[model samples]
Target: MKKLFRKILKYGLYTLLALFISLNLFVILSGRFYLYKGIANTYLVGESGPTIYDLDVFAYSTLEKGQGEDLILAQNYNKQKLSAADRAFMESMETKAFLVFKGDSLIHEEYWDTHDKSTVSNSFSVAKTVVALLISIAVEEGKITSIDEPVATYIPEFKNGGREIITIRHLLSMSSGLDWEESGKNPLSDNAESYYGSDLYGLVTRQKLITQPGETFNYQSGNSQLLGFILEKATGKSVTKYAEEKLWKKIGASHDAYWSLDKEGGAEKAFCCMYATARDYARIGQLILNKGKHKGEQIFPMWFYHEMISPSALNTADGIKNSRYGLHIWTYMAKSGQVNYCRGIKGQYIITVPGEDLLIVRLGSEREANITLDPARKGDKNYIESVRNKVGHASCLFHYLRMARTLTK
Candidate 1:
């Protein structure tokens, strides 16, 4: 018995040591050690560069304005129960910041020692949805003829790899049927390595098509990156510059937004890596919820807004297995009804319930393991699923808030 116990203890210690080393190595290799700390405030200019503000000053100054109808205090809500699971999950994950906004008000916000509002959190695939918005704008402007047009007409590089038949619509809906994978945290994977390396755009564009375009649904970040390339080719401007001029400035966004650039600085990633403050992120959500109208201006064409929420061709039976995909958006049909969202890796989300006149944004670390794994795999699962679940729950909170309003009336 003593011998058996000694062996078990020795193995346990070895396992623990291995896990610690693996985690440290993962962090170092991923270049996550340099991310900013704490949630800071920022000012957005229509066509000007972003001006960052200190969190402490912004919080105190904004609080003095006396919580307006648009602003909500974090202390008022019962977050202890509402977000207990999410909080615990975040503690376990390598989350640097978390923020939630309801309507035009910030309901809850928190940041780690290494992250702040001023620190730009990586957007991951959320940038795809933003690119969709740009495409819609371009279509309305008549820069790109239409979604039905073959993507090869705009970007010739796609002509060789059975990509000539793909349509702009296919890329928008993630139905490009391209052969690519985005296994998060897999260093051997293209996306995980590109996060720290250079020329991510070239890496993605060089991939070949696996299935006939519009025949199947494949979640490929490369498809979205191709869309970025097409947009730049069509408009004669970079995605970042175009977005700042048309959308960011017009929306009255109170902060500057930043987009991660490729090695050559020619391609701004449209599939991922956009950073903005919680309030500003919510403002973008509000614009979508209001059907791309802000302060009585039709910032985005109404037809574009309609297509953004409505199902696209790729979401049909012949496309991807998940029939809930819209134009770079995810459609969630629950017992209550249908809601559309823009989701990012590591649990970033912007959920819009049009019928409910609600919008919710939840940003945090990955939490998949917390919700999907059994006891043994829980620690290693990275907690992404759990954070995603919290995003869903956070949307429900908006429903409850509406219910409370009705009851008070």
Candidate 2:
């Protein structure tokens, strides 16, 4: 009887080892190990856990700092030190850096988790808004005709799979209607594969159309990836190069930024993963606050900037009763729906309130909580649905906005 039990245990152990080996082999061959490495470096906190900004994964394209003036820096200029509650709230969310701007001055700056002004981190989906800015510039420069132009005009590969119907505007507004299951938890989902996959252009171009384009709002990262491809084809320059020449160099960014490529010398991940410091990210918000002008130079056309902040008619018609989405930019509608910002997973934010002439930036490694759904608010349906499609919750956004109000006041 004892021999029979030992034999059963031995077989069980063998089966477990074989399963482990098979899983590792699949991850290695399929390039899904990026998901594992990303989680280990970003989420895991301890001595051996590396910072998200410092991850040495794919090849990166560096955005060199041009001969631009540094930002006007300040600390506790307007408000007192962060209250114990506010400080605890920010720290509890694992905040790495926080900065606030009123008009053109940096009024508050704080750092936690051994991160400082110079430390850079992955901006994640916030980079999507940056991509939107680039597309607007491309249109302004006549590299592309218009935002309403068909995406297939640039990438003929998109002429099939019912993708020819999608316009550049639709992609910018996250209304591509691609048949993508963007699940971070599911390794087989498009979101995970895009993050971990080696072939971004191939993965994005092959996506099947789930619904007609320009219909309803469905936030998918594939839209931005495809847009990146189109932008590259339209401008005859890589996404990184155009951004460096047009936006980054013009903005007077302090530190060198890096955009992770799908592979060495491959396409940039326009949907996500632009590594930059909180200070430089704030500069982006400042541009928006200044109506796409930097040092008296009209960077992005005022009309394009207006469209960026405006709510889409399609969004409103689709029963999306919130001021929560714009042209790749996120919006919050309090005090007459006048807030625009860029948000990222794991608590990265670049919030701008034009009315207040205020900008707030927060970068963090840990997500705080799921979204606080308010049944009383009509917009929460679409807002929560959009949040459900992302990698993390919307709870941090509320906290960030609340913090911004306090700081700005």
| Highest TM-score scorer | 2
The 10-residue segment with the lowest total lDDT in model 2:
384-393
Global Cα lDDT for candidate 1: 0.63
Clashes of each: 28, 1
Those runs of model 2 whose alpha carbons end farther than 4 Å from true positions after fitting are 1-12, 21-51, 74-79, 315-319, 368-393
> Model 1, stretches more than 4 Å misplaced?
1-117, 313-321, 369-409
Best by lDDT: 2
Candidate 2, 1-409: lDDT as tens digits: 9999999999999999998798789878976666565555445544232336653566789888788667785555646467889889888888898888888888888888778988889988889999999999999999999999998998888788788888999998878888877654565678766776678988887888887777677778898888889889999999999999999999999888999887888889888889988889998999999999998999989998889988665543334443557799986665544778888766788988898888999999776654444557646666666543222236677677677667766
Error of 1 at 103 (Å): 4.2
Which residue pairs collide, candidate 2? 333-337
lDDT of each: 0.63, 0.80
